[model samples]
Target: MRETNLDNGVLILSEKIPGVRSAAIGIWIRQGAAHETNADTGASHLLEHMVFKGTRTRSALEIADSLETLGGSLDAYTSREHTSYQARVLDEHIPVALDVLSDLVLSPSLRDSDLSLEREVVLEEIAQVEDTPDDLVFEIHSERLWNGHPYGRSILGTKLSVEGMKGERLRELHSESYVGENLVIAAAGNVEHEEFVDCVASYMDTVVPGVRSEQVAEPSNALAGLELVDRKTAQTHIVFGAEAPPHSSEDRYALILISSVLGGGMSSRLFQKVREDLGLCYSVFTFQSFYRSAGMVGVYIATRPATATRASEAVRGELERIAEQGLSDVDLDRIKQQVKGQVMLSLESTGARLHRLASFALHDEPFQGLDDVLSGIDAVTCEDTLRVAAQYYDPGRHLELRLGPS
Candidate 1:
């Protein structure tokens, strides 16, 4: 991998993998929901949609056809800490991919007509979230977990917020957050470092350097207990979570191992104990959401409304067990291998590498070789896992959300 910084403050990173016929390119901006005010909630996500609507030189259809005709793909997504626009194409179409991506980032029209249509599209998206019980529960959990912070709000924003969004407001946001200093352009697979750098440099030369927005304030650690929202669904969706280490913590590797052993797969403790043995409702798992300054670890289970209490008890039992006794050496070794294998397998894809590069750049995390990552996972000791579990897995600190028939 190679990295270059343009005078305009745009950072470009590239990795070349031989024998691959395709390349993945991504433009990442270090701004998302965390950067917005209460009045301008969801502007980042709304801007993501508006960018693809049109550009100064290409209409929406033209933007779509430009890549589709080449058997390529273009996509974008918004997250709490950042937003990404990515493309995958045959090596020969690298230039075309770069051109389209650059245009979307640099010259989006953000027209009133497009805004009017996209607003409804975003509104429908907000409704879709409300309609999905499982999704709505997590959003509710987040609101209570982060409580009063921008991070607590739904990424889709509220209906009223979207309705109030105007073309001029979104354009103002675009100008402020989408500047040169906050941008990272990354590409991997079947590309030369210098050539990719030059390709990006040409299009980004006009971007004026600007300061990045302030970082999000750290969230309070006060626990909000069991929040129940009534829905007429047959099954109940529950989430239990607490504060965990951020993306940059030294204990991150240990936390990953703990999360895997607790609920990562079919063989995980949650799946084996809750689903396989007790015959709870089918889906049960664990997840971790890591941001620059804060993170969350949680368990999710869906079961018949009658069994909600039992399922919750079973999850709590496992959490207490791990916090008290920790994992056995054999279990620790096994989960480390699982994590190492997953990381190695994912790096085989150019898209994954593209994202990894951009993310590492944004967080100022040093790029570790695959072997180094595997080594980090392997080096996590039973004692290390136990320490993390004791610190982060206290049931008293957890916030619970349940959505079901009341």
Candidate 2:
């Protein structure tokens, strides 16, 4: 892996891999939904859509066709801390991918007509989330978990906020956050670092090195109470969790091991106890959402409304036991192997490597080699898992959100 800084303040990271025929390139911006104000909640996501609508030189169809002709793919997504636009193509087409991606990121048209149409599209997306109970329940849980903070708000924004968005509003937000200093260009697989750097520098050199936005501090508010939304659905979707550490926390590896032990796989305690042994539900799992300053670790379950209470109790019991007794050396060793395998498998993909490069660059984190990561996972002892669980997995700190029939 190599890192370079363009004169314009754009950070470029690349990984050169031999014996591969394809490459993945991406432009990662440090701004995302967390950067929005209450009045413009979904602006980051809306801008992600508007960028592809048109640019100065290419219409939406042209942008789509340009990549399709090369037999490559183009896509983008918005997350809490950042937004990414990436492309995957054969090694020989790396230059084409870089050109198109830079154009979309640096020169979007954001036309009024395009914004109008895309607004409806985004509104429908918001509607789709409303109609999906499982998705909606998680969003509600996040809102309750991070109340009074930007992280609490939905990425899609509310109907009123999306409706009130205008072309100028998006332009203003873009101008403030999408500057050279906040951008990182990353590529991996079947490419030379210097050549890829030159290709990106040609287009990104003109980007003005404007002031980047400030980072969001961790939320200080206490977790709010349980939130129940009546949806009249056949199954109740519940997300129960408590606050955890940030992405950069030393305890992150430990939390990952604990999450997996709790609900990561069929052999996990939640699945084994709730579904296999008790026949409680069809789906039960644990997850973690990590941010720059803070994070959340939780369990998600969808069960028959009649069995929701029992399922919740079962989940609670498992968590309490872990907090008190911690995991056995056997369970710890098993989860470590599971995590190590998952990490090794993910590193085999160029796209995943591209993402990792960009993420490390954006977060200013040093890259950890595969062996190092595996060793870190291996070093986590049973006592460490128990310590994190006891510190961050307290039931009193947990917030629960439920959506189902009245």
Candidate 3:
């Protein structure tokens, strides 16, 4: 693993198992929907699509052709906290991967024609999410939890905000927010350290300084209560959320342990009780989404509307039980193993590895190694899990959201 600071942000380069023939490269930026005002709510996501439209020297088709010519693949995504543009290619095509990524990020043309088409595409994407209860529930969950914060806004962007997004808007956002100081390039797999650094460093050296917009203050914790949204469907979508620690918070590990006990896997309390024992729903999971400044823990489940209330009650019962009584040594050991296994298995892929490095670095932290991660998971005693449960998982703090038939 190699680490460096270019501009203000850190870059982590790891060349592992160099004999493996595939590689993944990603440019991760810290700007996202959370940084936007209401008018610019979807700028980050819109900017992601615009980058693919064309660059100053390369047409959209040429950009696609170059990568496809090398038998490689490319994709991008914008989330609440970050945006990533990435490509996966064979070892011999690392140059092509880095070149295309640089062109897209640094010199995107943001043509007028492309802007109009992508805006419509994003609106269609938003409509599709509106039609899917599972997807819609997350937006609703954030809305109720954050309660008028930018973090609650949909990353796909509101239809009105998206319609107003012209080519100039895209250029403005790209120029202001996609700064080198907030950017990091991460690569893994089948790479020689010196050659890989030279390939990426060459392009990054030419990157001009860009400006970042001011961040809004953290959301007011006044909405620290329950909320619900009612919808009509066959299966009710449920989400329970509460204030939790930010990324920099020391309690993050405990929260991870808490999430593990609740819905981390098939052996988890919710999975065993709700899905395996009672046959309530086909899907259930828990998720944590955090900013450097604030965070939330969310529990999600899908169940028939007829039994939605029962599922809600049972899930709540487990939360209260765990808070009050904690976990058995057997349960704690199993959860630790599951978390450790997930971390190890996911790092096995070049794409996943690059993503992990980029994300950790963006938060201004070193890549916590696999051993460090496993050790943290191992050190999570039953007391730690219950402590998080009592502090963050109090049932009264939950914001309930249900989308289905009444």
Candidate 4:
């Protein structure tokens, strides 16, 4: 991996992989839903859609065709922390990918009519979550857990906020946070570092060198221990757990290991016991959401309303068992290998590498190579896992958020 900066302070990171035919280039802007004021709640996401509508030099159709003609895909997504615009194509098409990506970020034409249509599309997106119990469960979990902190704000924003977003507000969002200081451009695959840097530097003129600031507030885990929402659905969607360490915390590694043991796969405690043994739910998994100064942990499950309480009890029982009994050395070693295997396997994809390249940089942390990551996991003793479990896995401490009929 190689890193450098354009004159305008836009950081560019790249890795050249031999024996590969594909490459992924992405532009990451540090601004996201968390950075917006109440009025501009969903503007970051809306702007992500608007940029694809057209640019100063290309219409939406042209932008759409720009990569499809090369048998590539250009896409973007807005998250709680940042927005990413990415392109994936064969090695020979890196230049085309770079050109289209640069145009989207540097020259978006946020037209009023485009915003009007995009608003409805975004509104539907917001509505779609209600219909998706799995998604709606977590959405409500965050809303209740964080209690109005930026972290709780939905990436899709509310109906009133989306409707209130003006073209000018979007323009302000782009012009302000999408500058060089808040941008990290990264690529991976069969591409040279110096050449990629040169191509990126050419955009220096329009890339603002000015600094952009963010006001980050870490929220207290104020949601009640249990809250059940009534919705007319077949099954009850549940999310349980509470606050955990951030990306920078050393406990971060232990948290990852603990979550995997809880619900990482078919062999995981939650899956084996909840589905295979009790025949409770079809989907059961653990999740960890990390941010700059805060993070969250939740285990999600869905089951028939009649068995929802049973499934939830099974989940809490598992947590309590692990926290009290502690993981054996054998269990600890197995989880480490499981995590290491997943990491090594994921390296085969250039898109995954692109995400790592930008993510660490955006979080203001040094990149952890495969060896470093594996070693970190290896160093996690059984005591470490037990410590984290004892700290965070108490049933009385975490939140139990249920969505669907009582």
Separate clash counts for every candidate: 0, 0, 1, 0
Report how far off residue 214 is in candidate 3 (Å): 5.1
What C-alpha lDDT does candidate 3 achieve relative to the native structure? 0.81
lDDT of 3 by residue, 322-380 (tens): 77866778877877777778889988888888877776766666668888778877877
- Looking at model 1, the pairs that clash are none
For model 3, the superposed segments whose C-alpha errors exceed 4 Å read 7-12, 212-216, 222-226
The CA root-mean-square deviation of candidate 1, after full C-alpha superposition on the true structure, stands at 1.0
**Model 1's TM-score against the true structure:** 0.98
Task: Give every collision pair in model 3.
Answer: 233-405
Better of 2 and 3 by lDDT: 2
Q: What shift in Å separates residue 366 of candidate 3 from its native position after superposition?
A: 2.2
Which candidate number maximizes lDDT?
Answer: 1
**Deviation of model 2 at 120, angstroms:** 0.2
Model 3 lDDT, residue 250, Cα? 68
Q: Whole-model lDDT, candidate 2?
A: 0.88
Minimal lDDT window, size 10, model 3: 6-15
Distance from true location, Cα of 213 in model 2, Å: 2.1
Q: Once model 4 is optimally superposed onto the true structure by TM-score, how far is the C-alpha of residue 97 displaced, in angstroms?
A: 1.0
